[model samples]
Target: MEKEEIIYGAHSVIEALKSEKSIEKIILNKGQRNEFYEEITQLAKEQQVKVSFVPQVKFRKYENLNHQEIIAFTSPVKFADFETIIESILSKKESVLFLVLDGVTDVRNLGSIIRTAECTGVDAIILPKNNSAGVNKDTVKTSAGAIFKIPICKVDHVHDALFYFQSSGIQLIAATEKTDNYIYNQEVNAKVALVMGDENKGISNATLKQVDAKVKLPLLGSIESLNVSVACGAMLYEIVRRKTQ
Candidate 1:
């Protein structure tokens, strides 16, 4: 196993976060009571660092080290800011295509989406920082390194990106069955933001209400719904086909 560079001490971990270091994961002591731990927790979240609250016994191997009940593993990947990337894309005088993910938490599914999005000419991917999956080794491996080829913007909320896209003339097209529209029925052109929802729950009611179009793939088999990644790939390819033909 490849050993990870671990950061011990609460203050050191916070400093790493403040410096915008690529932190892969942070494991906190579930039983340890510390005033600074909560602040560290919040900072880890703001930086999109994966966090885990394991039992104190899990820290036995690190008993010789001063972990302060908080240990952070450094990663090599970093994330892009949602607004900055979108603004840059909007500044360009050309059509834009974005994939917006809402509450797709599985890393493998996220990886598949990124792979397909990259192949389908998606300009960038906009994901919610909290509910969506973050870049990790599993996602990287699953994506077959395509994760690095695409630009992923992490926003505070999915709707924040959707609203901004709409205001900037990018149509917010969602993949959901709640509407009567099909993906093939709409003429996707110019600036377009394709929104994919959760694995089981589908798109959130709030998001579905605000999107410019709620489109779904026609279901003909006994399967009630397609996997989120598969469904997203289908929608992306459909858009590409429409654009080409």
Candidate 2:
């Protein structure tokens, strides 16, 4: 029983093999042979992605549909280069928008953020390659397939990406209750990256130190904190309203 997220269809798997997607493994039907078989095997070998051959009985779940005789269990989100995606976006849009996740380790939270980010026209999502939930089955499910719609940059450090964003003339706004500044007070009409931190710890002091501003959504409830996704959606929609209206 494979437990990872699966992407079937020869075109989909072939594109994944050609890109920088983290493909955990590929399974081929031993009884099936087609023109794409050689291409898929060669690309997988070149990318050093693991491939497995099994009987067609293993694909019983997908027998009713056209899976193109191939299955690829992969991290469906392809990571873009931090510098390259930034430069590319800046080249076209004078006012850009981005989201930064600081050690958000929950896959579902990450997915929800991705969904909101996509809906709000976020240029890309920056995440630390380490200590992050990243894309997975639950993430994809939570995002309602929005994971594939947005550009994601997996970098070595959150600080590095923040610094780069600043150098590129984009502002960094940290979303946290640590500050008195509210989301509505901040100006996100220009190029900016909204930074959200971990669920328990909030924004790290180290990360907060580098942000241009620290802002938070007003809380009237008894609780001091909100779920990361809900807070993020509120903040992003505020930005969207500012940018659009």
Candidate 3:
């Protein structure tokens, strides 16, 4: 497996703590002083990973070290298979909430969106194998440790995943600016899959046609569009809010 780049921020390091992959080692600035240090030490102990503190300059060479003053090196990023994700979610027997990214290439956007999705009770996050950002240390950092808690599935073809979800009784709701139905007004009953498209293109015409419902966020600002992740948060919470109500 190809190794992903290392991440050195607190949130990214914490998410790495929760991942199943073995953390070969962790590095910290010598005599690191912070409330989060206790948690990091505890987590490292729990995972049986070795931790050591080096000079602050050493950590500064690789990590942001704004607060935690810690960095970690772990195994390569693992991408889950589509079937495995489907089977796992089905076995859980919970209401399905999937967040799909169509050509979202920004790592921070993907990470922030995943964080929001996890908070909103999304079951899985789906991305196309190509043209989509995969799990990286920066992504984990941006997600604030939420990346470890959520299932991220990368597929050869996004349309195949959508087709599979639809066959598995999940409804596809595409979040786009070019839609008449606002997300707040939509019915997200049954298993729901919410798709957020690229920042530049929005959803492709072909993909939009495959969606069961095309919903837009109510924009009351001078700005024409919201960031994809922010828009996704809005749509996802709406689903959670409507379902539980």
Candidate 4:
């Protein structure tokens, strides 16, 4: 069955309305009103998007989340072809910071990664259609609704996607403790795609071999590796920081 898409929080909902994206409806908390609420209402009216006010408790049931007094249920994030993603990066004149997950199945980890990706300004996140977590209620709640703002594309095979990006002049970098290369020292300015493996087994050898470079996050203590989400955040922001500097 197809899962529903949810966008919560007043700021996120407001942005969705202001943008050209399609919104199914706006679910606001009952008895809540102020400048923000009024503005959202007017904007929804102008856009002709339906608005439904429910009790805080009832609205919580829609997302099973702490809706922050506002929530917006929209259609699934629009998925596009690989050619579209490549064209988008080319048009923006931005070095691509693409993330490809091999087989990360945990919903929470995927959700957290989505949140971090949005904050780090990643170009797009590519995941395999099978053996990957699909965005749902828990994911939306865990992402704090940031999934609504980020673009997620599902591919038939991650390896094919990597090759497609590589052919486009995008370097594929892998994060694994097995590598001698340090992620912090890597040149992040080039058109690069960062590949993170699943939490349990890390990257498969077949996938690892395709990587242009393998990098590791420094472990200061006894811990061998960072959690998938944490490692992704560290690596992503490092790329962003270095590129902008």
Candidate 5:
């Protein structure tokens, strides 16, 4: 990570948090309890920033510098405001085509999805603030710079975003293996949000409830399911095909 992408020292991290910077994660000395520790923890929680506690040995790389038992990594890309982007898309009277990700942590998969979404002309990609991969160097590279070209929105809770999209007349179509409905059989040409879930867990039951339709890709071979990225591509291209036809 670049020096500008990282904030070191307790005071610096606390200030960054106070300023509501887009911090990816914070690392602190494992057993060291300092005066600013509680304040940092509180601020991180309020900002929904992930905090990790590492051993003193882990700080050896910073031995030459004064890290003050704290380091925070800021996201390289600025996240978009979901509501603002949605409003703008609606104002243009354009059909909303959004890709909502739930608990997708792999940077490569996230990158591929972003690349595919951009190629597919998706309006925006929505992700939950927690448990989703942030736009970092690896993700950016994996996306072939598509991350910069697309509007990525991180929300506090994906379910809330689903609710808001539904209220705005965007049909929520969930891609899952648990459903009997197949994507080829569904109507996806209209304003819709395509939801892809965690690689292992699929869609959460609570989230599944909010979707207007749950569709799955048919697996006729030995493999039970396709990779998340490939499934996303198949689903998105299907939408493109439907719109064109």
Candidate 6:
């Protein structure tokens, strides 16, 4: 992370939150409640920014800096507005191809997925602002500069985004190991949004219930599942193949 990307101190953090800055996460000193605690918590809740409570000793790492018990990490990339982007896509009368991620916290996995999504001609990538990984220096490096080419939207919740896509006439397809249906059997040529989940847990039950179709890649090896990035590539290429043929 860059130095300019970090904002600390109580008043400064609160102002940033109020101004609707793209905050990746906020770290608060554990067991230290101040006058601004309630206000900060409420603002974070409203903005859907993840907060982590850590020991005071963690603040010692910042020499010659007064953190005031709170620090907010700002995202390196500016997030595009989902509604605006969707409206533009629809105005153009183009088939919608979105990559929606649920609870995917791994930075590298997120970067890899973005890289593949761009190459596969996905319209945009959407993720929840609180639980998902934010684009940063490491993500940019891992993506090999693909992060700049693709538009990323960080919303408050993935379920809400799924509903928005469905209302706009896009089908939702989820990739999970729990599914008996294979990816090859699905029809991907129409307006569709492909949903990928976390590394350990597959799609959350709430989000799974909203999907129009759930498909899985066959696992013939001893391993039961593939890495999220590899699985994402497999699914995306399958969509491309179906569209062409």
What TM-score does each of the candidates earn?
0.87, 0.72, 0.70, 0.68, 0.95, 0.93
Task: List the candidate 4 regions with Cα displacement exceeding 4 Å.
Answer: 1-76
Q: Find the 10 residues in a row with the least total lDDT in model 1.
A: 1-10
Off by over 4 Å in 3: 1-76
- Put down candidate 6 lDDT per residue, 56-125, tens digits, no spaces: 8888887467889799988878888999998888788566688999988899998898899999999899
List the lowest-lDDT window of 10 residues for candidate 5: 1-10
Give me the displacement of residue 199 in model 2, in angstroms. 0.8
Show the lowest summed lDDT stretch of 10 residues, model 2.
1-10
Itemize residue pairs with steric clashes in candidate 1: none
Clashing pairs in 4: none
Task: State the lDDT at 54 in candidate 2.
Answer: 90
TM-score of 6: 0.93
lDDT score for candidate 4 against the true structure: 0.80
Q: Candidate 6, 213: how far from true, in Å? A: 1.3
lDDT of 1 by residue, 191-240 (tens): 89899989989889999988888899999999999999999999999988
Query: How do the residues 58-157 of candidate 5 rate in per-residue lDDT, one tens digit apiece?
Result: 8888777688979888888888898998899888966768999998999899999999999999989999988887667788888998988888899999
Count residue pairs with overlapping backbones in model 4.
0
Ranking by lDDT: 5, 6, 2, 1, 4, 3
Pick the winner on lDDT between candidates 1 and 4: 1
TM-score of predicted structure 2: 0.72
lDDT of 2 by residue, 1-245 (tens): 12456789999999978884677568899988899889999998776566788998889988876887799987666678889988999999987899999989888998999999999899999987666774677888999878788888878789988988888888899998888998888877489889999988888999999999999988898998899999999998898788777
Candidate that would win on lDDT: 5
Off by over 4 Å in 5: 1-4
> What's the best-to-worst order under TM-score?
5, 6, 1, 2, 3, 4
lDDT of 2 at 59: 91
